[model samples]
Target chain A: MTADTVQSGLAAQGYVASPDLAMALHLALSLGRPLLLEGAAGVGKTEVARALAAWKRCDLIRLQCYEGLDAAQAIYEWNYPRQLLAIRAQGDHADEAKLFSETYLLERPLLRAIRQPIAPVLLIDEIDRADEEFEAYLLEILSDFAITIPELGTLRATTRPMVILTANGTRDLSDALRRRCLYAHVDYPDAGTELQILTTRHPTLNHHLAAQVVGFVQSLRKEELEKKPGVAEMLDFAAALAGLGVADLSADPAILQAALATLLKTQSDRAIITTEVAQRLAGKAA
Target chain B: MRGAVTRFAARDPGPAARIAGFMGHLRANGFRLGIAETETALAALATTDCSEPATRRALKSVCCGSAEDWARFDAVFDSFWRNGGRVRTKAVPSNTTPAKATREAEGQATSGAGRTDASDSQKDGEADTGGEGRLIATRVANLRRRDLREVVSADDIRLAETVARRLGAALRDRRSRRVKAAAKGARIDLRRTLRASLSTGGEPFRLKRRRRPDRPVRIAALVDVSGSMQPYARPFLAFLAGLMRADAAADAYLFHTRLVRVTEALRDEDPFRALNRISLLADGFGGGSRIGAALQHFATTHARTHVDGRTVVMILSDGYDSAPGTDIGTALGRLSKRGCRILWLNPLKGWRDYAPVASGMAAALPHLDLFAPAATLDDLAALETELARL
Candidate 1:
């Protein structure tokens, strides 16, 4: 979409994206800068990457991190079997150049993201989860938008990919990685925005029903709950009611309890939510 | 679409169908409202063409309920959807009619902007500014993450006050052990001397140096077993006995409103049992703590007779004086001047706004040579190390 039309498209779908993000994105596009988003979990950290890729029509490349994640998994590693076969086939005839060229070049996400001709959205989720060593390795590539393999030499992004990094604050991220991109933190929506979100998600529900569900969920969060219902949970609860065809809280409390799988993960949370309090609001299920 | 209708009118197919369609749209566009409610809200939304402004406003209101919840949700929505989904509307040229442009620009700033793009108006007189900080606090205070047990649970590890007590007790034990080592001279061997006298026809009398008595160190812990120290009593005593095992002279004592020497009672290996025994031994162990009275009793009855300048006094209490406040301070001051290195550790001071407010704290605060925050296991360790230093 044209710059002028971007706002209208979002408005049509019921979103109120701020102008600062628009300006930051525009500058990022102009200067080829990556965007870094930091925030709490379940606050739509990855959604930004998903939404950007959709809006810009680019491929989304994700590199998921956990303990013990290493450079070979992120950058590139050679195919062992292919390399063995090439070595056997060549025998003494092949030198380092010939044997190495054919089979010893397997690419990982970072290389794949850069090597692709089409610009892709590279999402580094939970960059803070990886250890300091992994963070350091990520920095060289992030800062230069390239990778250096001893065999392959430096492979830079011919067209720099639009990168977005999301962290959940398990640990503080390195300043170097943060400096390479524009930073933003993604918190959840406010009461009014959440209401819009519910209505936007579940159109069949009445205003009173939607408002009540949001109110109840919000109240539940304040209580020392086993698990908090996020925006995702609210939507799931609302959608579950609409599917059951109940329009108010006065009917069908059981379906709300039964649909507990959508919002609550643990059985204990479901037990707490589906009791008398949930029974009161279950009439929203038509 | 024109005016208000009965709640029954919402059941009509045209509006319901439209609502259902919109719910589907919401799902497709990626709002995770539950399966049932998605359909319900859609049914409600389809009944009328609520103005886009009103609908958006209503929708936000419903989804966002708590001040804390909305702040976080708004931040996430702005960051993810805005950065990733559609871009913002283009600004009209700055050269456009100054009056209208300025008015529009001013209108946009006061709305609750999240994270990076808080409007100038919001930073000012708007409700969002003063409230935004609170919102951040509330939302962040309840983060949704995997239940990392250690991070979520309120640990029962030593608090700052308890740590200080344990540290002081440990130091006192160390000092008492040193004093016992010096003061315990050689014991006279009577049997050997008599055997020599028999050889010399009963007139000869000589004595041989014998092994000294292995008297262990005694730690008279004048701990305040008052209701105020209930939470800390268990941990503090455990730490006390654990420190004493390492020191040969350490004897543990506890008090509430009166003095009771529990040196023999808490000789058991298990800390909990030892504490229980001491609690039973002390008369005021379960009563309101009187630090002044306990100190006065120990000084008169036990000071020169049982305890002496060699004795290391360790006081483990929040310093709450049930007696007159001035007396508690005077008594503690006198006790300190008598060669006791007074170290006062308060737990509440570990908190950001903790001030010396309690009468006990006021009484004892001035006498403390070493004041520290001993709120956690680490703080206790720090307290121990400080004792070791002394």
Candidate 2:
């Protein structure tokens, strides 16, 4: 599909992707390569995968990476309990080969994504968090869409899944992994995009309030605070304001401070964005 | 006349030739675009409707690898394509030969450093008298091996920081408390074994095993920022910042007469900003060296929570303590007993005839697990392998 098609598709899925991002995603799909999305936390890198999955009408299989993520956890594992049960049931006539068969195989996200009859969106979320060794294991699967199991030989993908890897820059990802994938740097949305996103997500909300909310968040991001309010946080803030039946941001100072609980994640962030700062942002937002 | 005619023809080259020239320009700007990336970009261009903006975006996705690359792509792209395929004198000077530009680019790319600013190179160009390109190449090579104390230029400091960051990335984590699946391990993985037993009708045929997980190394660095260490402190702090980036559990403290925890300050993504924050926090930075008192303070107050058996306590100091007779050994002994590895990195240790003549150095030397030189970027880089072994 064209970049415009991808952009429109994402927009339909309520993800207002930037032109650059849409281009990156389109190129990734066209080339049939993994797309590596790197950005700060709360920038909605994971949301892109969900949006793509929704757009494609495919299953979103996510493999959440952590420090010790290994092959057994990510790819596949043999059901040892099932194998033992079968052996016991067979009563010394148990076949060794049957134990490692597909019936006893527990398919993890990676394997399950590949083994799907229809191509799915495989989201390897926060890949930088995973160990360097774990990344080495991913090289084969990423490049060739195949996994090598000593027992089963090599199991290639029936339908090549669209792979999307997101990293929060915790550690420098290996150059090998970077080379194999198309790259996109997903920053926080701009004012216009944020307004579009806010209105798209919350259509029933008053247009004036939505604009103010977007404007306030944009200004708040410009503030020197840890963990600037992301789109998700802005949406939450909007929801909170709507739930509270607040009209103007500048009108309810106490309520604005209270509603900031949805936006400000850290104690320092909350402290930094005080009632005065919120009101000031709201005043400018008008 | 033939060479001139070829140059004239090359000025109005084909699309493929233009792309090849663009890739070369990208390479000169440290874009790490190999044949594979070039092919990907070409394939992207072929498949898509090649509008200028669309082509730029498409090529960017294929060509740019890291965040640094993504940031630099537009400038490089615009300079190559928009500027009529002529290499900007600012980027690759008109004066510099292609061979020299390629060598400099290779040096910059392989160093894990970001692109040298055009202005910085212009300054370098202005400074050099004879064999300018060779001098630039030699300078890049020399920066790594040069003493941090002798490193005066801001450019050298930036390069040092980049090398330090790579060194930090190389620092491997030791075995952790968490267990991972293993072929043969001391601990029995009951969860996996029981899960596996399901196929064999309630009979445990396979005993699943697990070993301790390999987690990132926890570093607790106590850097001396005293008056005596003024020349070395900045570079060492940069190294400490690298360690902090590599290991989330890493803690940094600046020590002079008093000990101040700069871990929070150093967590800032921008190294310069982190250093700026640290400068503000380090109240008595240029005071007399009091290694013993600082160690005592750390051991008594901070070590209990921050230091564990797996922690690597890295002390970057010359060991010229103002309080020589005070209890450095006692504090180090306490940390050592807790099973933490204490590494004493003295900048002065790089001297050929260097001895632990200083009373503080002599006193603390016996307590150290590893006492090595931290005089240069190369010396710091060597610690990666040393740390991995530890």
Candidate 3:
């Protein structure tokens, strides 16, 4: 599909993707390459895969990466307990080839995505948290859309799934992995986009409150807090204000400071944005 | 689209030459574009609507490999495409000297060896001629090998920081407790093997084994910013920033008469800006050296949480103590009891006739696992190989 089509498709799915991001996705689809998305913690990198899957009307398979992730957990595993029961039931007639066949094979996210009849969206989240050696295992599947097992030889994809890998800059990925994928960097949405997102997500909310909420969150990000509130946090803050029936941000100082639990994550962050700072930000937010 | 694809094909020499020239310009500006990336960009350009902005965005996705490269893509694109394939000298300072840009581009391809040769040639050229060009080249070469105390130029400091960053990214991995499946391992994985025995009729036919995986080593550096170490503190802080970038778990602290953790400040994406923030944070700099009290403060406050057996505690100081009766040996002994390795990087050791006869250095010498000199960038580069052995 063209970039414009991709943009419209994602917009229908409520993902408001930038033109550059849409273009990157279109190139990745046309060229049959994996896309790598890097950004801050909560800039909606993972949401892109979900939106793409919804737009494509296909399955969304997720593989969350962490330290010491290995191929057995990511690609496939054998159902050993069932194999043993079959061997016991068969007694001397158990065949080795049948035991290791597809019937006894358990498919993980990677294998399940490749084996799908229609192309699915595969999301590898927080890839930087995995060890460097784990990246070497991904090279074969990413470039060739295939996985090699010693017992099963090689399994190629019936339909090559769309792959999206997200990293939060915890560590540097190897150059080989970076070279194999199309790249995009996602940043926080601006004030206009944030307001659009809020109104879209909560359609019944008042427009004036939505503008004030988005304004306050945007201004609060400029403060010297340890963790700046993200888009998701902004949405949560807005929901809390609506639930509390607070129309104006500067009207209730004590309630605004208490509602910061949805925005501020750490104790230090809460201490930084005191009542005075919140009121000042609310005054400017008007 | 078919006509556009045909026009951009190799058979048509005009667009092909332009694309190659653009790729060359990108490479000169430190974008790593190999043949695969070039082919992808060309294919993307041919199939899509050929608007200039769309083409630039498509090529940017294909070419950029990191955040830094992504940030630099637009400027490089404007310089080459908007300027009619002529890279403006004002936009890119590296392109001002064609020879230097070409040399750096070549150096990028061969990695480390080509850069060493480039620096060596500069030194050799300086020995032959007394011209202004040769003099500047000589100064650039000397900056890498000169003592940090003698370094004064901003350009030299920037170059040294870049080298320090590269060196820090080469940190070696250490074996961790987490295990992965292996053919032969130190211990048997009973859980996996038991599960595997189902195919064999409850018989343990094949044994499953596991071995420890490798993770990046934890590092905590405490730099002395006292009066005596004023000259070397900036360069050492640059090195510390590199380590923090390489491993996110790494911690950094600065101390004079008191200790202040600057890990959050040094975590800024810009190294120069992080150094400036750190300089403002450490208002106690240029005070009298209090190595003993600083060590005591770290051991009492932060050692329990940050230091473990896998950690390497690096103390960058000259080991000169202004507090006479303070106890340094006991403080080091407490850290050593935690099973962490302590390393001392003394800039004073670079002197030809320097000795560790100072009371503080003599008391702490026996507690150190490694004592190395860090007077120049070359010495810091050498420490990479030394750290690998650890």
Interface RMSD of each: 26.3, 4.5, 3.9
Per-residue accuracy of model 2 over A129-195 as CA lDDT, tens digit each: 8988889989888888888888888898999999999997766687799999999999888899889
lDDT of 3 by residue, B183-221 (tens): 679889999898877666678888999999665557889
After superposition, the stretches of candidate 1 with alpha carbons farther than 4 Å from their true spots are A1-24, A199-212, A267-274, A279-286, B1-382, B385-390
Which of the predicted structures, 1 or 2, would earn the higher lDDT when compared with the native? 2
In the range B143-167, model 2's lDDT, one tens digit per residue, is: 2221122112334446655665665
Q: Tally clashing residue pairs in candidate 1.
A: 83
Candidate 3 lDDT over A52-114, as tens digits, reads 999999999999999878888999998877877887789998897898898899999999999
True contacts preserved, each candidate?
0.00, 0.71, 0.57
| DockQ of every predicted complex | 0.01, 0.40, 0.42
As a TM-score, model 3 comes out at 0.66
Worst 10 residues of 3 chain A by lDDT: A221-230
- In model 1 chain B, the worst 10-residue window by lDDT is B144-153
